[model samples]
Target: MAKFISFAISILFFVSTASAAPKSDLWERWDLSNEASDVQVSHAQWSIFLSKYAAYVDPATNTRLVDYSAVSHKDHRVLKAYISMLTDIDPLSLNKAEQFAYWVNLYNAATVDLILDNYPVKSITKLGGFFSFGPWNEEIVEVSGEAITLNDIEHRILRPIWKDKRIHYAVNCASIGCPNLYVEAFQSSKLESQLESATRTFINSDKAVQFINGKLILSEIYNWYAVDFGDEKSLIQHLLNYYEGPLYQQLQSYSGEIEYQYDWKLNEKK
Candidate 1:
């Protein structure tokens, strides 16, 4: 009876954690994009919001924290307006780069709005209900008359459409362990460099990779999205692409077990 109870608990734990990471199933509607189109989506309002609220809390780690509690009523309305503007735009008419930037900014703006609506909470996971891990599954916005959840923007739209592992770095979950929310909105003109910078900043941070007493520890983002990164060896290679300096050398020499962890605490300014 004891052994059976232990096994059942293990299975329950696996299910809970695994279910939190939705698989990258393609949403065919979002697959439509014009590669040759020159239209650009304006993220000016979002850029203004980010500039006012997001800041680098830790220079050494590049931890860009958001001031959720500091958001004014007027600024909150501006955020909603920004999201509404994005919803009104036809992403299919824009080029692939524009669409990418559009989705990323929309996802981030909506996430911040969600947190503000439920401020004074200790963590994002606290708002999503008893069985829910976080608000990712909640339908927070509607684009082109279709209601969309955070998971849809990430797993269904961004991940499947781009197939770039860096997509993981671009989307923020409003958590300390996740990549910093860009201080400026992602622009189509600088999307490549922005993604590259986000990836490099994250991989070098202790939140993403840490070597403690000879053991290699990584973020749960890597473990949850392992398929996006490929097998264990492939994962290391992917990390190497962004990792630099002495940490780069440490990773090269270390052939050991990798452990993964994540903190769901809100990435709020102190």
Candidate 2:
């Protein structure tokens, strides 16, 4: 079975990488093709697994801690099945909204699967690959016969196609510095509301923006995806959309250079 799966993935990687055409600075929208149509893609299986094992330390901080050790053997099998179901669905056949939800959920799910397969790791960055520390660049899943990686889903597909800064919130890296993973799987029906809520919630968290020595220290995500949030002034405006209280007032009054930091510790439950 493992050999068969490996052969299948090899073919997918060749096809997906070989047929790629040049993309413009902007990615084309999904569901724009003449053959595109709506299709049902269920995330129930993933939601069930999450509800059984995921939890937030405190609602106020939105710090999620996944009980990796608590995940039983049966649940792992269920997760593999969910990933298989997602892989079988042709994302090109789904509408724009469903496509967006599909990629986000798939990325998050794949990330979890990677961590689970190598449980007890202190950090995701510990999952070393040929050229990098983390396995982000590894093509761990295939969809519609196209082998895809976490980086491909986030950078190549979601980020460029949507051009929405809120995407950084929706996709979690299973790290303490990353945004909290949503307990419920993202669905096409609630895509808009979920995206809005994710953005608002993350910005309101101390991880998003905070003061240190009177300097505004932001997440390295904003720096890494600087273009996604626009200029520093514009990024501040975006944060103000959800930030409040004394820090909000401080951000409003203080105008200087902003620094960034990130913690790669696993978001595992104690």
Question: Pick by TM-score: which candidate is best?
Answer: 1
lDDT of 1 by residue, 1-270 (tens): 999999889878955884568899999998998889988888999989888989657675557888887899999998998899899988888889999999999999998898899998888888775556778888888888899999999989999999999998889988888898987899999999999999998998899989889899999999998988999889888888888757787887778899999988888887
Task: Quantify all predictions' global Cα lDDT against the true fold.
Answer: 0.88, 0.80
What TM-score goes with each of the models?
0.92, 0.85
Tens-place lDDT per residue, model 2, 184-259, is 8999898889988888877877788889888998888887777777887888888888786568789887788888
Off by over 4 Å in 2: 1-36, 58-61
The global Cα lDDT (0 to 1) of model 1 is 0.88
Clashes of each: 0, 0
